[model samples]
Target: MSYPDLLSFAAGLLVTGALSGVLAGLLGIGGGGIIVPALALALAAMGYGGDVGQHVAVATSLAIIIPIGLSSARAHDAKGALDRPTFRLWAPVIFVATLAGGISAGLFPGKVLQAVLGFMAFFIAANILLPFLERLMRRVHGSATAQRLCAAVIGYLCALMGTGGGALSVPTLAAFGLPIHTAVGTGAALGVPIALAGTLGFLISGWNAEGLPPLSLGYINLPALVLIGGVASLTAPFGARLAHRLPARTLKKVFAVFLVVVGVSMLWAAFG
Candidate 1:
């Protein structure tokens, strides 16, 4: 790369990394929604070609999310909020389901993958906004059984959406009468499995694709991964601190609204 191109890449990396870090911190997500799209645009702008650009972007974003999730999980653990017993119960189910989802993504066509992402964003937004769903679940709740079921569902959805699982898992747990702090902390832990499984699938599936951009690792773009992952790791603990200090009610409402807007935007991107 020329000096001018290198400079541009550096600028792009910083901007993307900063934006992703802020979103990850504020929302308790691994910033996959923002990172994947930004990466696709950045790669295209940098003159990467072929029909595989978006796939590479998504895969690379997942690869970066592995470390981001680990960092966030650690922060949550420090707060004594993670549900270790519950996590142990659900981890195996989530691992299997996430692997299945990843394989599906890898085997599916590009248009189909895009449509799935669009639909998932909408579904996730609905889950965020509907407090009544939690009430309904609570009406039928039993000891441990309900929580296990919820975890399984959350794991499946998280894999399908290409998220760290916290996007849906945290809220689901909160709805089940788990304190918001515990839910968020436990949800963060789930991200580690999701990222690991999802990244592996992307790498395996994209291994044979040609015309990949420089610094590529299978579908992952190494430069973006390093930049986004590093900054997000640094900022996640701060976000955890903020989560502890802020009122859960306020954060929940704010996060729901944000999900709605982001969902709409993603749908627009997919169909428009």
Candidate 2:
């Protein structure tokens, strides 16, 4: 790449990381929604298109989420916002399911994964924005068996979509009767196990994949991971502070609107 292009790309990565880190702390989203799509576009623009590029994007997003999530979780915990019992209940199931999803990711088409991300984003946004849907979600609480089932699904889908699982987990936890802040805090904590297991699974599964980008270990792009992860971890605490200051209603609206944009953009990217 020319020096100008390299500079632009570097700038893009830094901006993406900053925004993603803020979202990770604010929404407990671990920055996957932003990172996965941003990395995919950046890779494609740099001539790394097609399935391998998408794989690299997802894998790298998971790798980046590890530190971001940890930072967000710590910040939330320091504020006494984390719901430890719920996190403990969900963590193991989420980790195992994410591992399974990551290991099997290569079996699915890139478009399929992208579509799943898009659709789920829309669903979560709708659940937040539409009062009836919000009411419906609230009415859907259940037993331990049911909650565990939901956690499994969240983990599996998060692995496929390269998300931190907060987009799904936050709303689900809220519906299960936790306060929104507590849910967000716990969701941030849950992201650690998901990212750790998913990263390992992707590393193992993509080890022999063809046409991977240079400086990649398996599907994870090393340069991108390091750059993004470093910047994101630094910014996450700021976001967590912001989240605490925002009202619960405003926070939900912010998350919902964010998801709407992500859902629409990702769907367009997937099928356009």
Candidate 3:
């Protein structure tokens, strides 16, 4: 890339990163909700090849989230909301499931992956909006086993969607009876494993994807990583602080509404 091109890329990346960072901090999400679609659109705008641009965008979004997850996790840990024992217990399963999901995405066609994303969005939205569903699951018995099962399912789905797993993990944990604050905080920590496994999987799977864009690191867009990761890291502490002060019940409901909208948008985009 030329100097002018580099400058322009940096400018765009900074803007993307700034917005992603604020959202990550505010919501305890790794900002994949924004990153995936935005990066896809940005890559296309940068003249990346039509065939592989979306794939690269998805992979790159996961790659960038690694650091963002770490930053958010650390901040949450400091706030005393992270459940170390639970994280330790479930990390291995989440790691493995996420890796599997990443591999599946890499091996699948773009259209298939898009459909998977759409379906995942719908499922996650349902999880958010339907407290009764969780209560029903609990009533079915084996609640402990059910929680682990839900976690595993979320891990796999997050991997497929190129997310940090916060969107599903947080709500699932909360539904399982953990405090909402604890769920969100621990969810941040959980994102680390998901991102680590998912990023590596993407790297391995996309190592030779045809027609890769310039300056790409396997499937990752380096400029986006630098910008988004950097800003998110810096702003996460603020988010942690806000999480403590806010009324968690209200915040959760508001977030659930947001998820529904996002889910519908993804569905429309996929099938429109």
Candidate 3 per-residue lDDT over residues 29-142, each given as its tens digit: 677777776676677777773437767767777777777778777877887888887787668888888888777777666655556666766676677667765676667344
The models' CA-based lDDT, in order, is 0.70, 0.91, 0.73
Going through the candidates in order, what is the number of backbone clashes in each? 0, 0, 0
lDDT score, residue 36, model 3?
Answer: 70
Better of 1 and 2 by TM-score: 2
Task: Using lDDT as the measure, name the better of candidate 1 and candidate 3.
Answer: 3
Write candidate 1's Cα lDDT for 30-109 as tens digits: 76777766676677777773347767776777777777777777887888978897678767777767766665565655
TM-score of candidate 2 on Cα atoms, chains taken together: 0.96
Candidate 1 lands at a TM-score of: 0.88
Give the range where candidate 1 is weakest over 10 consecutive residues by summed lDDT: 106-115
lDDT of 3: 0.73
Over 137-242, each residue of candidate 2 has an lDDT whose tens digit, in order, gives 5555657777788999999999899999999999988888888999899999999999998998899889999888889988899989988999999999999999
Candidate 1's displacement at residue 51, Å, is 5.0
